[model samples]
Target: MKIKFLLMIGLFTGSIIYAQDSLDTRPDRARIIGFSPAKNTKNVNGMLIKYYDEIDHEIKPKKVNGVGLGCNGLGIFFPALLLVSIPSIDNWAINDIGGEPLPDKMNKINGMQLSIINMEPTITNGLEVNVSSNISAPSVTNGVAVSPLYNFHHTTNGMAISTFANVSKKCRGIQISLFNVCKDSRGIQIGFWNENEKRKFPLINWNFKNKKS
Candidate 1:
C-alpha cells in the first residue's frame, strides 16, 4: 500500500509539473522564489512573514475564491493558525447595481466552486510560517476567477508560517500558471504568474517535514 501510494503521489506531481511546464516556456525572465531552511532568527520571520502576509492579504480571496481579501477569510485560508483578523469597514467594500441587492452580487461574485485540499503550517522564528496548497482544476473554461486562500502552521522550533494562493482574470495582466511542489524536507513552495514579475505568487506552500503521504 505504501509503495502504491508513493507511486501515485509521484505520478500526480509529475503531471502537475508537466502541465505547468507547458506554460512556463520563458524561463529566462521568470521570478524565482526559493525556499530554504532558515538558520538566522532575525531575518527569518521578516522574510517569511513578508512573503506569507503578501500571500495571505494580497493573494488569498483574490484567487482562491473570488472574494476580496479580508480578515474573516484569513483563517479560512490558513487553517493551521486559526488566527482571526478583525476587519475594518475599509477592509470591505460595497457597490450598488441597478435594482440589485448587495447580498445577491456578493453571493455570486464572492464565492467559488472550489475545494481546499491541505492547509497547515509549521513553526519557525517565533512565528507560524505555515504551508498549504489547493488542488482544483479551473472550473470555468475562460476568464473565471477564484478566491484567495491562506494556510498557517508552526515549525518544531515554534516559528510561525503562513502560505497564500489566489487566481483571477485581469484585463491587462499576464497569465496565471498553477503547479505543485513535491520535494522539501520542511516544505515545498509553488508560485503562479507571467514572465514579468520578480516572483510568481505562491498558491500553496506545504510543510511535509513531520508528516508522511
Candidate 2:
C-alpha cells in the first residue's frame, strides 16, 4: 500500500511539472528576460528586463489594474489605469507590414497615459499627457489630451489643449491652442487662429448644428 501511495505521489509531481512547462511555452504567457533578438519579433505578455526598440511589438501586460512602468517600446493591448513611462513608444495597434492603417484592429487605451516624448495610440479614452507632443490616434479620442507642443487627432469628443497647435478632423468639445484647425467644428475653439471648413475666424470660432424646431 505504501509503495502504491509513493507511486501516485510521483505521478502527481510529474504532472505538475509538465503543466508548468506547457504554460511557459505558450506564446502569450512567455515572460521577456532581457533584450532578446528572437523574442522581440513576436508579441508577448510579460515583464521586460530592459528597454528595446522591438519592445513596441513584444512586451505587453495582459491587464493593468495597478501601476506599470515602461522604459521604451511598450505595446499595451489592455487598458492600463495608470501607466508611467520615460520616453517610450506605444504601438497598441497592429500596423501592416508596409506601415499602413488596418482600421479594424485599432488598439484602445482606457486610462491615464503619461509619456515624455509622444503618444500615438490608436484610441485614447482617458487623459493623455505628454511633455513634448501628443500625436493623435488614427481613429478617435474620447478624453483630454494635453501637450506643450502640438496635439493632433482624427476625431475628438472631449478637450484638447496645446501650446502651439491643435488639429483634428472633427471636434465636438473644446480646443485651445495657438492655432486650431478642424474639418468639422461642432463646439468652441479658442486660439489665435481658428480654421474650419465653414469659415476661418480669428480668436474664437464655433459651429453648432442647427436643431430643427
Query: What are the lDDT scores of the predictions, listed in order?
Result: 0.25, 0.54
lDDT of 1 by residue, 1-213 (tens): 999999999999667645543554443322122111211111111111111222222222111222211222343554444225523323211111012111111111123222232221111111111122221111121223222333211111111122232221111111222321121124333454111112222453444335345
> Clash number for model 2?
0
Model 1 Cα shift for residue 194 (angstroms): 46
TM-scores of the candidates are 0.18, 0.55
Which sections of candidate 2 miss by over 4 Å?
Answer: 1-102, 134-139, 210-213
lDDT over C-alpha atoms for residue 160 of model 1: 16
Q: What is the lDDT of residue 111 in candidate 2?
A: 63
lDDT of 1 at 35: 15
